[model samples]
Target: MSDPSLVLHRIPETLVEALMMSLRKSKVEELQLRTSVLKPKSKVVVPSMRKLLTTEQSNKASKSVGRKLPVPSNQIRDIVQHHCSNKLTKGAVEAIEVSFEKFFKYLCRDVMAICLHAGKKIVTQADIELVMKRQRFIKDNKSLQILIEQNFPLEYRQLFIPVASSVTLKQRKKN
Candidate 1:
């Protein structure tokens, strides 16, 4: 009778031999397919690397050179009219748009800085809330701070609750 150990060792050897044979067979089949004279039903054409790069660069250049305001003027006008009792002139609307853009840009810079400082590549809601909280404390504009708090009160609560829970979990683990 064959020993159990011998049977186990022979089984693995057979498996390895079978695996090698299948690999060789597949490789030979691939080579034959490559060398065959039959043409593919459809031809694929790949653009040259340089041509692709140049086109991409030109597209980016055009986009950056002729960039429009982030928010449309008409939309800003609509928002202003919806909120304000008085109708603002076109120049006032334009000024609001410009100032809004500047403020938005500044906020984005702060959020990005916070994300980087936290050793995270993607900016999460938590990062934004942290920046907003800091900004709320620092800014003297009560109206703007109140507006932010009102608009995202629930979001801020949801983000912070999870963070507090995580801290408690870590403390428990330590204990």
Candidate 2:
């Protein structure tokens, strides 16, 4: 009791091996059964990642989302594989697709709210930008505009971009 010694109370070899296997599978900081159970300094997220990672997408309560996404699955696969050294697991790819779908749904939902607020039935890029501006901690409307201009595919950039215009100043001479 004074020493907190449990060496006399030995664990079965199989249990010890299984615990080590689970720890290794989790890919956290190296732990050994030297004294007592050691906890990692920071959490290893494979332990916390929800197994119910969505494979499909859901729409907002107001509108039905399109089943087909603009970005092809192959493109997602390619991107994931490129980052993962030419390897993509089926679960990981599907999770990525679902995450994108969910992100898109929320983005559209906010944009739709803006349209509804303005008493307009059409959702526009302007509405999307407005929502982003309103949602951001600090107003940086042009930042998002610039991001779209830079990252959007060249073919589509001209169609819906909000070109940020520079304000000009004139000096008046006073007597």
Candidate 3:
């Protein structure tokens, strides 16, 4: 964090500079989290942005803090404070919220699609894991993955599935 007092240049004097400054302020983040597990490779969407946004269920997400979004900003801020940085800025929190929302949306979409295609009304962790295999996950450490997977309490998971695979698969006969 740069000290406000170590002054080098003056504030935005022109309109263009002012707009740029405003954008920069809105995008301040200590860490750059991946927005979506399945992000578009191209910056410009071939299909209109409006159509993509509307079709992707982005409207289901809320931007305001304290709202019941898919991934709450407060929870993300807490996670960042606990694991990554203690002195993160508000902009960083907003960024996390945005990324989490996208990631969660993609996750739900993929999981639901898989379940529906399989003629199942209920979605299971197996569906989620299958989708994850096809999606692009963030660059988190293996230790972090292990920690999260095994961080469950004894009561939540009492002598059940093995660490290797949680879901039980049925065997299919091949002619």
Candidate 4:
């Protein structure tokens, strides 16, 4: 079979100049030839490429995702909308919601218990403090105090010093 003559054609000077300038600007000597080569070299994404996702590709991808179920009626989607605004895998969003729901349940239970015990309609910061005081888990212990300080919120930064000092004072021999 006669090898097809490799045609060496001169691209129009204007086009070649444009391509050379673009190559220089892009800091690459040559671009690989494909649909990408035909794209107008620019910082912006190629508009044509953006539109190249064929209906078949779209259909196959959409089909695999399964249809979104109708939004639930009870919960205002607005509350969760921020959490869901960004693109996330289905499982990731489910896990995050599950985690937040668990945390919220624990927080509400603690608040409710304090409110019930106090016989007060309005739960305040003092109620939270009182609960913290009564709690046997890691409230006054120095090692646990340091662990809580490192891990938990720094709302009461001064509380750590007092807690550590109180532990030392209790251990000291009084005159």
Candidate 5:
């Protein structure tokens, strides 16, 4: 058997060795963390104006930035042809696209305002219908009103129908 004094000395040495090993491990981990943090990040390269103007690059950039992309000119032309038996010029198609973007922005703003007034964060179809109703589009345009009534859901079409007052009903009954 080992002597008690030797055992006691060995005990302290083993404890010191364990403590040193733990300290070394912590130091190595800390150094690794420091090295990882100190590594240089790759620089972002801004594309040249010419590259940005390219269709493919612009589409990629627009998609990455979550911007509302303009409708393709061909699709716009197709829509114009569908509505009227007339072909639009290149400039006319561009003009229509710009006007559409402006109208959409204006409509979205009004819908968002309605959503906020209703204590909601997300825009809803009901909010858009409310905005359209408030804008008096259905009242002003008979054709558009008819189109909406025909295409839209029953709940949406009900918004445009005038309600008869109780007084009017009573007077009608008396008459």
Candidate 6:
């Protein structure tokens, strides 16, 4: 068993530099730590930037640090910090919240359409292009009368049909 106080000697400088850079980077802020070691020339205690480790770094550093690697980021951990003093403001949050419902609905509809057309229920980065293309096609071809409503079904066109129908209604009823 390795002693907690006895850190491994003769650690590689690149690994140390990488460790320092990774742990000190904005992405891994919470795990930041400070350690001091004497430089051979300076003979003074200098703070070591190589104090913490990323999951990858920690895994490699584990062989030397003699402990389990740190956990990687997940949805919960990735939530952007809501520091009041930061540039982000309540107005921005409110704006996002206001559109959140519409955003999710559009996202779900797009994903479902892609799945229905492609026969793949699982969404991937590749599906993003198809979704964007479909949206652009609908937006660009608004003035063009529905030539083949058969290909694009009613359920998906419910939002667009009203606008198109209003422009050229066969029976002129009321002002």
Candidate with top TM-score is: 3
lDDT score for candidate 3 against the true structure: 0.55
Cα lDDT, model 4, residue 165? 51
Q: How accurate is candidate 2 locally (lDDT)?
A: 0.58
lDDT of 6 at 34: 25
TM-score of each: 0.40, 0.40, 0.42, 0.28, 0.41, 0.26
Cα RMSD for candidates in order: 24.8, 17.8, 17.1, 21.8, 23.7, 18.6
Candidate 6, RMSD to the unseen true structure: 18.6
lDDT of 1 by residue, 1-175 (tens): 9899999989977887787677667766665565554654534333222322467798676546632676677766765676578979866876787787788899889998998888889988768767877986435455433554344433343443545446556889999
Clashing pairs in 6: none
Query: Please, what are the lDDT tens digits per residue for candidate 5 over residues 1-175?
Result: 8799999989977887787677667766666666667764633333222321568887667546632535555655655666666767766875677777788898878888888888998876667667877887655555454765455444434554443244346778999
How far is 87's C-alpha from truth in model 6 (Å)? 4.9
Q: Please say which candidate is ahead in TM-score: 2 or 4.
A: 2
Off by over 4 Å in 4: 1-93, 130-138, 142-149, 152-175
Q: On residues 1-175, what C-alpha lDDT tens digit does candidate 2 reach at each position?
A: 5443454345455576677677666554332232125553534433343222233432232134434666788865754554466567776776788888887888788888778889998777577767777777226545765665555443345444533221111222221
Against the reference, the lDDT scores of all candidates come to: 0.66, 0.58, 0.55, 0.53, 0.64, 0.49
Model 3, which residues run further than 4 Å from truth?
A: 1-67, 136-175
Instruction: State the lDDT at 80 in candidate 3.
Output: 63
Q: Per-residue alpha-carbon lDDT of model 4 for 1-119, expressed as tens digits?
A: 54344233434555766776665555432432333467756443322212235789986675476333333312323334433556556566555555565655666688789899779
Best by lDDT: 1
- Mind sharing the TM-score for model 5? 0.41
**How do the candidates rank by TM-score, highest first?**
3, 5, 2, 1, 4, 6
Q: Please give, for residues 45-157, the per-residue lDDT of candidate 6 as tens digits.
A: 33445455569887566435422212222211223232233554555653444355466578778878888899997887558646765666434554223522433344334
